[model samples]
Target: MKKICLTIIMGLVIVFLNGCEKVLEKTPDGQTTIDKVLNDFARSKGLIDAAYNEVYQARDQIAFVFSPLESLTDNAFWAATYNPYRWHNGSLSLSDPVITWDWSSPNDQLWSDFWRGIRLANNAIKYLPQSTVITEEQRAEWIAEARVLRCWYYMQLLEFYGPMPWIEEPIEPNYAGWNELVRPGYDEIVTRLESELLDVINANIFKPRVGAVDAKRVTNGIAYAIRARLLLYNASPLNNPENDRTKWQRAADAAQDVIDLPSYRLVPMSEYKRLFIGANTTPVDEIIWRAWTDNSHINNTNGVDVGSYPFASISHMWNCGESPSQELVDAFEMTNGALPVTYNDATHTTVTVTPEAAALGYSEATGGDPYSNRDARFYINIVHNMYNYGVPYNCTEPYIIETFVGGRNGFNDVISQETQRSCPGYYSGKDKQVKYWGPGNSGEGNEPTHWVLFRLAEFYLQKAEALCELGDPDAAATALNVIRERALQPRIQDVPGFANTQEFLRERIRNERRVEYCLEGQYRFIDQRRWKILNETNRFITGMRITKGGNGQFSYQRKKIRDYQSYTDKYLVMPIPLEDAKKMTSMLQPKAWQ
Candidate 1:
């Protein structure tokens, strides 16, 4: 292992790394590196943070326009030229243009990152208990934390690349038969992860919940949350191809376990936006796992950043890196609980709306600003034409987002100097953009935030989806209404035709997830996959082209950004990177990809 000193170990493990350099530090020939590193508690504890660092670094893949996950989904359009856009269309490969040769900094090859994280978590587990300085209580908690963290990374891998080879223990430096492994089935993957987490939960070692002071650490809450999410995905169309009701029931039960946890609850709708950006010393248990940049990679004196893309978009320095899509904006229902628009086809040309909603004055028509009185989450998440952006922390004046033709945030017909020029119609909203610029909002870019991973609202919907699939529509509606009510929208049962059938209720729950988790980490991206609905969500993308009139009113029309046929059957699950897949021999690639 030391001879190769490979950045990625032979198996899916990252044994030694210091920016993939030959040696993180040197020692005498007889002093093996692991022994040197595990000499004390401080160094052993650092291993835990290092594992956490792997996931935190992966967050950069979605930060700004670098390698945004939302760009691959229908939610946001990343128009910057800094990185290749092929990934957005499912063509990112070894030949990808801007990222063709480099996988070091952007860290876009997540397969490596996930395994690196697992290896580190395993390192902590194996070494921490052996440390003389750690007390029994600390040892127990640290072991649980490492196990849960490892499962979290596995969950991510399963979500992205489907089932993987099960590796429980850290690969010893001298273990040589890594290539003998083969990918397991989803059932084995689920059993292994579920059993492992259940073991921890039963051990009663994990903190029931962590305060904002310790928010980033793994807690009992997240183990249940992760298990719920994993099982929910496992029960979805892509993973459960059998339409397994039992799996759905398992998913529902797992989500219920999270709900049973007393500490976690939705931070009121009023606090939703702030929950994503502001620091909370005493968090209200809204978020289950709020991962933050732990100072290993990013430097931030202020609260942790929510990954920095939604900064005041009109600023010259922070140009509109990501333009929220019209498709996503349309998904947000009118505040009165009427869907603003529906499409005859996924291309987004044919639009329709409820005539009842229209008669009551809720409309998506562009006769004027169509963003009025929408879902509470809508206002919290998107910066529309008249919405404020680019405001200074101290300034009394507000800078309105101007995305009309020839406006400050204009439409780009090409790759131009003004990045905002390419904006569709809206920018992502993090109203605290003013406060997140840097230390005390000093116009620098690194602002730390609690950056939510698993949250109560997500579990609500997860429970709803699983219950719906398990043939318990009423119970699912109960969970679904929790989210709807929190968003200040009408309940699912109250929505006219939505309660008429299980299928209708299912669709309603899905749409809630669409808007509720808009532009959030891979939620939309993976949902479309597991639901097997890419034909509907990924066929094409739209940007609202705004033209301003002399009367200072803006007119809008949805324009096709581009059409893609790249979302074929193979894309339901991502293919393992070619370099890594080759080494795994037994599972060269997802069969469809091959």
Candidate 2:
């Protein structure tokens, strides 16, 4: 006889043993006495709460550094401006590096956390079958939620590690051979996710409404969002391009389903900038699903403060960790509906701009607009000439210099110490909380902000991109216009230099995604991977030179140079941390890449 100690608290049961308990346990009733904990409404809620814990754990544990790595590969940031040694200097390794420092490889942690989530979800599924505490419909809904969330966890593994060992069952000691599991191929993982997700979605088991601080918790909309994103990624150029059309079509359809649901809508134009800073709730209209957090033990603050503030905010104000590269900054077309070069062709010759030339609204003698006539999002996201009052220390407010410092009384002297100072053509105001001054005691206050995982706008953009990619120009235009109209930006036809062709539409959709989704943790690198544009444009950086004038004025000039020396195939898929590869034994690096 084996003794199994089962303790039921809330709705969860923990199985432990006094000592050396065998797998076979007999109860006094002559039934197999496996540790069984009955789940009531309270226990179910407790389990749900436990599942939500993974979001915070994932963020603080693995996501912080890993997420930034993706952005660093693209033009979003340079080594010099933020901390230089990390991604910019190529110092980050599977081993040791700088910035959000992590000594252990992220692979195991991410793997463990995701599985932990899966286990909790599995418990929910298993218990839902026999539990009599809740209504049948409610129980079924809970199961659907668990299944969707479980699939989502798997999706994360799929995206990062490629084909991971797929585990649907909760781990038990009886499964002794499970440790010898081998990684599945990409197709196997995809097939399982596709099948499971379809069933989960069709079951319609979740409460239709979004939850509060629980926004980060998995919901039906989130499942749909993940399916759409996964299918789209599979269809994009990054994976096998053979199924590009079919994958994108499925992606579009998934996104459309979310769009059709009245529960989600775009956050109004007025709330756009505030959406990321944690000011607004998941705007019911704009958010489909998000990992929820509140003021409790898991206050869900994201990396926006670390990424946006440039040596100013008190709590986390260091120089901007990920400054937008000149290339990305220039991606925005002039508000006047023309490329910067069209304004003055001569500026194209030089990369740096003299102070005199900069004030005149051009980056260089050749031509670039550092400040004037660009998309609204450009100004909203990139910090250029704005003066940030350093809270209590007003005098310490950093003045952004867009040109080189030189000569008597020049603007350059004001901001010369910062690397890539000349490129501060714009500061990211997106998600900036106005009340946050400088660090604590410096008069700046920090607030509990939530991480927004899903917004309705993202679905719209996803659909638009997919539609355009699938060669449906008109439908793509309609999708894009839906978002644009909400933003109050001119429609495609109303704007000048607009071509409604597929290629043009594609570019337009891409640009829209870049602007709309900047710093929300999605950007060109992922886009490049999905579009298979990494090889063509990954290393390109558009830069400008700044010069000072005698009157202490600063100016910027544009240079049309695409520098690609730093990028390599290894950069495409991050190198498997050497330690992780050694531990796994079977892990292989992505071929023909780095």
Best-performing candidate as measured by lDDT:
1
TM-score for all predictions? 0.86, 0.74
Off by over 4 Å in 2: 1-44, 56-71, 78-112, 127-139, 174-188, 208-214, 278-284, 294-316, 341-369, 387-426, 438-448, 493-500, 540-547, 557-566, 574-589, 592-594
Clashing pairs in 1: 303-448, 304-448, 304-449, 305-447, 305-448, 305-449, 412-421
The sequence of per-residue lDDT tens digits that candidate 1 reaches over residues 322-406 is 5678888878887667777777775686677676456556544555557777788887777776665554444445556566787
Tens-digit lDDT track of model 2 for 1-594: 011122122222221111112233232344322233334465544444454455532222233332333334455543232323334445545543233324443323444455556666676677666665677786777777777777777776555445566665544544444235566666567767878888887866666454454445556678777777777666666665565487778879888987887666676777665555453353545656544443211111221222134555434333333445565665555554333443234333343433333444655332333666556666666655433322333324443333243411122222223332323233344544434444444223544444456678877888888888888888888899888777666676665567878888887788777767775554455676556566556544444445655675555655433334335554445544454455455555556322
Give per-residue lDDT, candidate 2, residue 500. 74
lDDT of each: 0.66, 0.53
Off by over 4 Å in 1: 1-32, 57-65, 81-84, 94-108, 208-213, 294-315, 344-346, 360-367, 389-391, 415-418, 430-432, 436-441, 444-448
